[model samples]
Target: MANGQEWWRGSVTYQIYPRSFMDADGDGIGDLKGIAQRLDHVASLGVDAIWLSPVFPSPMADMGYDVSDYTDIDPTFGTLEDFDALVDKAHALGLKVIIDQVLSHASDQHPYFTESRQSRDNPKADWFVWADPKPDGTPPNNWLAIFGGSSWEWDARRRQYYFHNFLREQPDWNFHNPEVQDYLLDCVRFWLDRGVDGFRLDTVNFYVHDQLLRDNAANPLPWAQEAVRPFEMQYTLFSKNRPENIAFLERLRALLDEYEGRTMVGEVGDSHHSIDLMGEYTSGSNRLHMAYSFELLGPDFSPKHFRSRIEAFFKGAPDGWPCWAFSNHDVPRHVGRWLEHAGDQEALAKQAAALLLSFEGSICIYQGEELGQVDTVLSFEELTDPEGINFWPEKTGRDGCRTPMIWEANAPNGGFSIANKTWLPVKPPQQARAVSAQGENSVLAFYRAMLALRRAEPDLRLGNTGFVDFPEPVLGFQRGDSLMCIYNLSPEPVTVDLPSRITPVLEQAAEVGDGSLSLGPNGFVIGRLA
Candidate 1:
């Protein structure tokens, strides 16, 4: 890597979900112009980059996760010129731009899928994963989609079943086909030529499937209970996480290497093998620059859970790097998700940023986490997320998290748009936490300070993490030899030894003295190692 080539390593990336980020046209949907207009806010946070979540042309069957065109922006978002302008503006603001690349699948309406599904003998027939139905015409295998049913959906056009790990409208691409791989690479090159800094590969592990099409085995471990999604009942060994994907990643990496200072961070969605695969995908010099998993984004909030995930990643892939985030468009915001374990939402929000920023890898900050944005409470009729709609009472979907971002507290639709209706409603609770309503002591201010602190302190950014022995609900760690960080993960106060030779940082979230560190509810201390 050249000097500054590893800009993504240990950097802070602000993720932008285009549809909810901001609306420039009063059309009730966020667009590229909206994002470009908001660059100053993102740059003000000291984030090194902005990762846009799929702005490509799409039928939006999966809310932009299913791309219809590989090389152009969706009409709802903007055009190629608008995208180029957004990239230029981002670079001018000293922030890199990372676009989402959903290579695992494409919208069923994509020309490639449209052409391939027409007939088995067409030039593009093998472009997507198409298989003959079993002898009984009951579909190919027992692989289930994350959305709830069998992964195989019958295509009447070809008289066969096409595999999809997500919605049936999003068809999986056949990475086993060399031409398909070449096409995807060409799409990547198009972006690189247009000057994107990197890519956030969506569902990175689902790129390739087992060639044999064998049935997935039953999940080994008892999840302690019933799974909300039937897909969780099986291990999906054949449907995804295939070893063949590594070769494709290498090819992608090689293509990225063609451009200077470029990088790629993949989202590993595996449950059982996430860590192991995170290691394998980024372990070497010829793969992804960084990979992140759902380990930290869930409801688990404890010293044990934190220590285990971080330590496990390093132990499994010592040479690999990880990007960590507490919230994203996919999950419920951390403020609400971890409130059961760590009360005092504001304190927890600041504490979460402190803990995540102090860790030893690149960090991602979701759009409204800085504002202490909690998940929006929506009624069944107001829900828009398919997952939330599919699993209704049991699982209100990602719409709670994907609601249009709140900007001005009093502005209509929380300043997200002037239209009478936005894609998702901006509830009062969420609007109350808007940027305009925040103060100096607010979670938003704390985030700005914490992020600036990380940027200024090399140890916080480039340091290797060493877990400090601490009791439950209190997470402690040494960041390289320069800093010591300890946090109280619960609402109850706790006093513990300062681990010796540690002095409180100027921006300490709480008090410390007399060789004993006192942590209030959701309190934390980042100290310099003397």
Candidate 2:
């Protein structure tokens, strides 16, 4: 990377979901103290930073995402003093802390929203998105919420409809109001003053909405195999991904720039225009340091899919930077998501770790990814996520992936908590792959090796990539003329001719014999060109 560029360029960040990471207070829920106590394990992975999910005060309406207080920590999680200690411990371990900033919306229980709904003439009345109903008392627009039903919630006190893109309890903030922007900026400053190194902007494309309150158009065609919610039918142009969001991001970037060596990564959730939006949000220096899409987090795991997604982003905006992750808190774990393509879970996990580390951008490794954690099967009674409950049986919600982290094989609650029950149950299968069970050649060790390899080789981190012409299951890419990274994403062993100038790196998952390179099922190799 360029000398003056921020540390986020080609950095690997470990994502910690607080509710599932560890429980220090024995309340069966993870908290700030738990996270602070676990910094050693994160530092051991050779990652440059840690990106924490939301830990702000909330009503638990949407876990911590539907934040009621932005400037302080929730009592359940701990206090502001505990957060400061985590930051200090992390920095001492040479790891940066990048917390989630849910700027697009706030909980309906928030003081701003409470005052806004009291009366139309209140001081904070315009702080949120509120619209008048039609002549027949219908919603002004046909936009739908991500959770389910209409996006607008009828406020009895104001006798008007308020916009909420997710849960009705989470009201979308009005970026059109300068005071709202100032108020949010002040909240951001609160963290910056507390010594946070960076932020991961949650639903960054959703800060602004169409001022005209226009209806969303129907999707040209259903992209997913099944549509579980009404929101999927529409393209969602008026509800989110507005052009005015660019100016707001610029303002946010300006605030981040005030701190030395700080960075920002925005999450773009738009399926159709995510890559283009990622390019736009990160291309200019005045915007996000990096932005990630759901492209890698989806069910598509073919060589063509990976190549096309990577190539398309560079094609759209060559200067734009991207952050890639195979699994996160939102989606089903990649192991289960792409299980059909796996010869074996362990083999696939190792191959995936190598492939992700070889990619030419920043990387985010979810908490359980190193342990090869799969989605745990949960019954309807065990389901806690509303997204899953809304479409249960047919579509399992994210509860499977959000189970507590397994740190020990035999310990109760898998060492996540001392309490009798966890927020999510820790199944026996998850405990089997706990960190304590890993050895020198285990999946956890393989993750450490892959991360070390990425750090040892600069080209794998920040090199220009060009795909080699190859068929399905075999992905070949040249990184900066020196690194030739190849992967066989199939169960059957395959052989490919080695270019005369390239010498194999002889990594554990790869092999070279005579003039041919043979890759085992779910194997990969990174060779250095002579």
Candidate 3:
């Protein structure tokens, strides 16, 4: 957490999924002006910065992941003037703006992709990853798409197959080509010139693949199961996480280095070698500033699981900085998913906030987490997520968590939009936890308090953490110099002998006694070492 090395260390970032954050117009889709109007609300949370999901012109194939134009703002989101105003307002509010950069691919409608597919020898023909089909007319390699099925799509116009790790309409870029690299760099420059602080690189490891197109090996783990998609069964070593990606990351980092205090966090999605890859991406000064793994976002919510994940990253890369998040656009909200074991939802939410903030790395708070929002239950007919639509009953898609933010309890569309119908239904339970309802001494209030404490208490922010010996289901760790944090992860109360050097400074739940600690279910305590 050195000051000169990485500016993102110990920073709290709030993620705003633009389409669901707030809608200014009656179109039911959230826009840049809506985000600009809400800047004060985000700043009031005491977060260090805000990370906005894609607002660039897109075909809406994967809901903005399939970008058609890199420089222009989507008309549905806002005009260029609205985006500039948002940048100005965010900076004025002392909040840094980090945009989502999906550089792995572009929409098929993009000029680069359009020209590249027109003919085999077009001027932009080599800008995309195009390969010839095998003798049997199958894909050149055995690469799998994260969405589902094969990674390559047959293009009749080009008489070949093109790589697409996600959606079929989103074509993978040819990062190995220097000209393509320069074009992507210019896109970065376009945003950097507009006063964006940094980027959250999407599918960062998928930037490059084995040029020879080797088949990926079978996953050796017996626990690996084909649950939501068949793509989860095989190891992705050959398809992505190539050795060539690191150099390109360095090149991207060098461009960002020109902007003072700018930072970047890569999304590392590999189940195998995630932490190791995270280390490799963020270890040196020339690579990404931070990277987050899906380890915490996974199903495990036990004390042992949390400890092992954090310790593994700390051990894997001593110099690398990590950013942690329990919930995001992809997964079910932590409150709803962990509710069965976490006891009272309200208390558990505070405990989660405390646990995340106390971790020895940067933290990302998903929108609606402050109010302890849980995933809204959606019927199959109401689901909008493409992945969810493809998976059906086995896995309810991300639409549960991507529901619109609730600002007023009784307002139409929870005040997210004036439209009569929303993209996703905003439930009454979620509406009850609206910002106005919880002005102070609410879950949102507790969030602000926790963030303030993390900011004020130096030991909690950038301190080295070491686990304190404790019985099962009770997690205890001591931050550097002071601050001993303990969490009760079980269904019943647990008592532990307090360290003689420590005294209770903050108790998240009143049922937990002061000084000598006795934690109820889902209880957590923050104490200062004497």
How much is the lDDT of residue 38 in candidate 1? 88
TM-score on alpha carbons, each prediction = 0.98, 0.98, 0.97
Off-target runs (Cα >4 Å) in candidate 2 are 1-5, 222-225, 506-509
| After superposition, candidate 3 runs with Cα above 4 Å error | 1-6, 510-515
lDDT of 1 by residue, 217-317 (tens): 88876881378998888887889999999999999999999899999999997768988988899998999999977889888888999999999999999
Per-residue lDDT of model 2, residues 7-74, tens digit only: 89999999999999989999999999999888899999999999989999999889989999999999
lDDT of each: 0.90, 0.90, 0.88
Clash pairs detected, candidate 3 = 501-530
Model 2, total clashes? 0
RMSD of each: 1.4, 1.4, 1.7
- Candidate 2, residue 326: Cα displacement in angstroms equals 0.4
- C-alpha RMSD (angstroms) for model 2: 1.4
